[model samples]
Target: MREHPRDPRAAVIEERIASRPQGSWFTDPDPLKAEGDVRAVIDAARAQGAMPVLVTYAVHHRDCSGHSTGDLTAYHDWIEGFARGI
Candidate 1:
């Protein structure tokens, strides 16, 4: 049987990626829940000595293929809640 060799650089790259600050995506349909979740993420990031980066992807007709699609009015409300979280 042949032994498989692993690239030592892969571990270093993975560690670097894990050490970096990551952004959180808010895709919940419920505005209230999204608000609370965003706030929690922000708080957690702050506690970790990192700034929060958020991604809002709940807009109506997102991607134009029915993926993450929602009503415009609801999207507006969701954005409002997301803002409140910040």
Candidate 2:
């Protein structure tokens, strides 16, 4: 576990598990689809009297394989566009 400077009382835990025989698949989000897609979900939830939560996952060096990755500046710009679309 490791602690972050921004949250002194909070700790982050990371663990690796053994691989299973069954295979797994992964899909990445399309930034182009994010605006309308996210807004549609948020609108639906609002109509149902539910609050929506947004989580930002794009970060520099994410996945360590150049997949689903974005730099900080790009992240901020994308988020701005997403908010505008909402």
Full-model lDDT for every candidate: 0.82, 0.53
TM-score of 1: 0.71
- Runs of candidate 2 with Cα error greater than 4 angstroms are 1-31, 61-69
In candidate 2, what residue range of length 10 has the lowest lDDT sum?
Answer: 18-27
* Candidate 2 C-alpha lDDT tens digits along 1-86: 23455664333322122222222211224454556656776787679796665654544466767766666776666666566546
Q: Superposing every Cα of model 1 onto the true structure, what RMSD results? A: 5.1
In candidate 2, how many Å is residue 68 off? 6.2
- What is candidate 1's lDDT per residue for 1-86, written digit by digit as tens? 02423766777777898888777888887889888999999899889898888998777787857666667898889889998988
Best-performing candidate as measured by TM-score: 1
How much lDDT does candidate 2 score?
0.53
lDDT (Cα, 0-100) at 4 in candidate 1: 27
Instruction: Report lDDT (Cα) of residue 12, candidate 1.
Output: 75
Q: CA shift at 83, candidate 2, in angstroms? A: 1.5
